[model samples]
Target: MKIDAHQHFWALARGDYGWLTPELPPLYRDFLPADLAPVLRVNGVEGTVLVQAAPTIAETEFMLGLADDNPFILGVVGWVDFEAPDAIGQITRLATHPKFVGLRPMIQDISDVDWMLSKTHTPIFRAMATSELAFDALVLPKHLPNLQELVRDHPDLSIVIDHAAKPEIAAGQFNEWAANMVSLAQNTSVAVKLSGLVTEAAKDWTVSQLRPYVEHLLDHFGPTRMIWGSDWPVCTLACAYDDWCAATDQILKDLNETDRDAILGGNAARIYRIKGAA
Candidate 1:
């Protein structure tokens, strides 16, 4: 069951993607599953985990609706009012839907790095903990410690750190990001998305430029804890879907078949809890 564990969906007119800019024109418009499925077929990916790129609960519901209709969408990581009084109720309700696998808050949008670390967010964290869903931290390097603490409180919950903490690979700031990643990976239960690297590199970066980050993640998380993601149209800012698929292939070409299988799909199937009859 080959899976891309971290992907996105959005409508441009919704004005939801805060990161979408004219500079990121490629991803500024609609990127529905219809636009991406062909690319998945070309890449030999069977199903995907639709991650949150929208900024509101309405967007989460909308994506959930899409997932309900789309069989290829095996799992969804939707957003919610993490601080809402009904936080637990909402997650409990959403969890009944098989595709609703996890939840995410746009932690990167908050100016204060510790916003999610506050006591205010504990109920929401605990609710997700009770439901046994992942809290996909869409955060930056600075927020890892806070995320680490969140994991500590909810030991039963899984934390999938998106995009290797969205590292600044283009600027080539490797050491600090590498250290933070190593520290986070030390948490046995935390997993990582081996996606979104193109956005961190030069638009036309060669495979060599991405080697160190990929190597570090593979070295830290190993094949058992890391999964691949397309980051899709967002990836278009740096490379196309085919380009990313090709790069991922080359980056892991040296691995044994089993390790390669784990990075590509085995770990994703296990982490996202996708049950494929094969």
Candidate 2:
């Protein structure tokens, strides 16, 4: 099954997403499964891993509710109260629902880049590893060094870097981001999502500008460690969903069919522990 490993579904009126204000007109509205199913069909994608859009347990519950109804949603990566005293208990409860696949701590939004590396989260990390959950790192380039440490301390944890650490492609910030990612790939088994590149590039971004960055990631992570995502309505801020699917095809055109399949869906199923992976 072809899986879009990273995407989001949010209702603006939920009032949980603080970053999502009226200023961003395109994404200010609701993006539900009904809106995405046809897009997935047109792109030949079978299912998707729905990720958290807001930093609240409420949002996670909402996504889980959606997953309960939408069989096409392979897994749901939701948020949890890391600071809560009973965070582990929360994981235990959430894991009871088979479709709750992972948790994403919005590292990029936190003021302290070192928040994830805190000693406080050690048990939380342990619980996630015990529960067999994936850690979706929503981080920035500056957080790469600490993220590497995060991977090291919890070697058993299945971690995937979101948006290639949101490289500053529009600002042409490549060298540092590339070097950091290369080090992460070299030292740890962390996976990465091949999504959100369109938003990072110029509004009139061309395939040429994206080639070098995407090539670097593919070379370092290889298809086995790289997963595909749409970032969807958020991606719509940059280009249409069909455009991203087309661009990804053009970029991976040289890869063998097996490698292409791995990045597209095979790896996601294996990483997220979804059924029918092979």
Candidate 3:
């Protein structure tokens, strides 16, 4: 099965997407399943993991509701108040929904770089571990060290790094990001999504500018721990869906069928526990 492991669905009227405003014309409006289904079809993608674009539980419920109606949505990585006093109860409740496969705290938006490692959040991590839910780290390179610590502390937590830590490819620098990525990959339990790179690079970015980072990830995480994601509407900011799909294909052209399949879909299926994805 071909899966777009990460993508988002949001309604502009929801009033919860703080980062998505008219300022960003491409993604300022609604992007629902109707808008994406054709793109997925044309790209030969069978299913997708709908990730949260808003931090509110309302958005999570909204995505889950959409998933209930959309068979192509294999799973959802929603958000919850991880630091809330009733976080365990919240996680337990969310886990009852079979489609709620993972949780994502927008760590990148949080000012405290060490927020992921706060002692108060440990119980929440434990609850996630107990629920067998994956945690999508929405982080930047600076947050990686703390992320490594979190992975080490919660070895049972299935963690996937979103957007390959959002490398500064546009600035043409990789030493710091690559070093942290290599270090983080030491924990076999952690995986990464090869998504959002096009938006991070120069507007006219070439595959050559991305090849080094992609190769670094392939070398360190290997295909088993790597997953592909379109980042969808956000990706449209830099390029179209088919364009990103073609770029990803070119990036993985050197890999044999087995490995390529894993990065493209298999790894996400295993990590997110997406039903019937194989």
Candidate 4:
């Protein structure tokens, strides 16, 4: 089954999306399942992993509500206050829902790079491990070292690096990101998402420009550990939905069918442990 492993839905009326403003006209409007269903059907995408666009627990409830109504959404990756006193309690309560697959702490937005390794939040990570939840790390290259440490320390915690650590492809900045990614791949068993690359590239980016990074990911992580994601409306800023999918298809044309299928959907299902993946 083809799965758009990372996509988001948000309603501006909710007021929880602090970063989404009217200046970004393309994504200012509400994006729900109905808006995405037609394209998914056209592309033969069977399922999706609905991710959080806001940091509030209330938004998590909103996502859960959407999951309740949409069967195509295989799982919901919501957000949580990592340093909050009731963090574990929030995790426990969210884990009760079968669709609540995991939580993302929005590490990229935070000013502190070493926040993920905080001693104060150790128990929260443990609680997540106890609940058997995945950790979607939304971080930049600078945080890769600290991320590597966390991945090594918490082997039980299923950590998936979101957007391949969001490498800066637009500005031709690759050496440091590539070196860090190599380190993570060599040292930790962390899974990296092949999503959000388009957004990180130039506005007029070509598949050729993105191919090198894609190749690096494949070379290091291989197919079984790599997952494809659309990054959806955000990706629209750089490339259309179908164009990104096409670019991915072209990039993976050389890989065998089994390996291609794994990158497209199988790996996501396995990494997130989505129920009824087939």
Candidate 5:
């Protein structure tokens, strides 16, 4: 099954998407499953992992509601108040729903670079590990060290690094980012997502420009540890769903079918524990 492992659906009226402003013309409006169905169909993507766009638990519930209605939505990576004293309780409740596969802390948006290392959050991580839930690291290059520390602290947590830590492709520099990624991958338990790169590059980015970073990820993480994601609607900011899909295909064309299958869908299924697909 071909699955787009990382994507988002949001409603503007929810009013929790503080970062999604009217200034961003393409994504300022609502993006629902109906809007994405045709795109996924045309791209030959059988299912998707709907991710959180807002940090509120309300938004997570909203996505869960959508997933309940859409079989195409295989699972959800939603948000929770991880820093709250009652975070374990929240996680326990959310995990009852089979579709609640993971949680993301939006580490990149938080001002404190060392926020992940806080002692208060350690129990939350422990709870997540106990629940067998995945942790999506929505981070930037600078936060990678803290991420490394996080992996060390919670070695068994199913952590996936979103956007390859959102590399500096737009500026054509990835020395530090690459080094950090290499360090993190040494954990062997961590996984990386091949998504959101186009939006990080120049508006008219070519496949060649993205090749080095993509190749770097494949080389460092290997096909088994890497998963593909569309990062849709947000991807529409720089390229269409088809454009990103085509670009990903071109980049992975050199691989044999087994490796290609693993990167595109197999890894996501195994990592997220997404169900009901043959």
Candidate 6:
């Protein structure tokens, strides 16, 4: 099954996905299952993991409610206040939900890019060890060093690097991004997501413009550590869902079947510990 491991859901009326308004003009409107299903069908995606876009427990509950009705949504990487004094209880509460597969903190929103390396967050991460939950680093390249340090301390934590460190491909800044990417991927516990490259490139970019970034991730992380993600409506900023999928397909056309399968779905299933698909 082809699994798009990174996608999102939001209700504008809920007023939770606020960061999207300024950075994601194309997707400022509500992006429900109704809006995402067609794109999935067009791209032949069989299932997806609904990731968090806001920092609210209600957002997690809301995604759980949606997952109940949508079979395509196989898992959810929802949000919760990890640093709360009662974080252990909160993690226990969230663990009861079958769809709750992981968590995200939106590290890019934090002022201190190195917060992941702090001792304060270690306990919160340790709390997640109760259920062995994976954590997505929603961060930029600047935070990669901190992430590397975090992996050293929490060897069991499955940290996925979202958006390949969000390269500055639109401006052709590949060398720096590549250096950080390689450094982060060196941590065996960490995995990389091959998504959001189109948004990092120029609006009128061709498939070739994104190949270097895609190939770099595959080369550095390899198939076992690389997973596919659609990034959904945010991807609409540079290209539609179908366009991004097509570009990715073209770029990997030369790879062997095993590697292709890994990037498309196998890696995601194994890394997220999702049942059946792995």
RMSD of 4: 0.9
Clashing pairs in 3: none
- Per-candidate TM equals 0.94, 0.98, 0.98, 0.98, 0.98, 0.95
Per-residue lDDT over 132-156 for candidate 2, one digit per residue giving the tens place of the 0 to 100 score: 9999999999999998888889999
List where candidate 4 sits over 4 angstroms from the true fold.
Answer: none
lDDT of 3: 0.92
Q: How close is candidate 6 to the true structure, as a TM-score?
A: 0.95
Angstrom error of the Cα, residue 244, model 1: value is 0.5
lDDT of each: 0.84, 0.92, 0.92, 0.91, 0.91, 0.85
The list of candidate 1 runs beyond 4 A from truth reads 18-23
How would you encode candidate 4's per-residue C-alpha lDDT over 153-243 as one tens digit per residue? 8888888999999999998998899988898888566899999999999888998999999999999998999999999989999888999
Query: Where does model 2 exceed 4 Å of error?
Result: none
On residues 1-278, what C-alpha lDDT tens digit does candidate 1 reach at each position?
67888888888787777787778666667889888888898888998899888767788888889988888888889988876788788889988877888888888888989888788878887878777788888999888877777777777778888988988877888898888788778866789999988887886789999999999998988888888988876788777889888889999999999999888888877877765513
How far is each candidate from the true structure, as Cα RMSD in Å? Answer: 1.7, 0.9, 0.8, 0.9, 0.8, 1.5
TM-score of candidate 5 relative to the true fold = 0.98
Q: Of 2 and 5, which scores higher on lDDT?
A: 2
Q: List the residue pairs that clash in candidate 1.
A: none
Steric overlap count per candidate: 0, 0, 0, 0, 0, 0
Worst 10 residues of 1 by lDDT: 269-278
RMSD of 1: 1.7
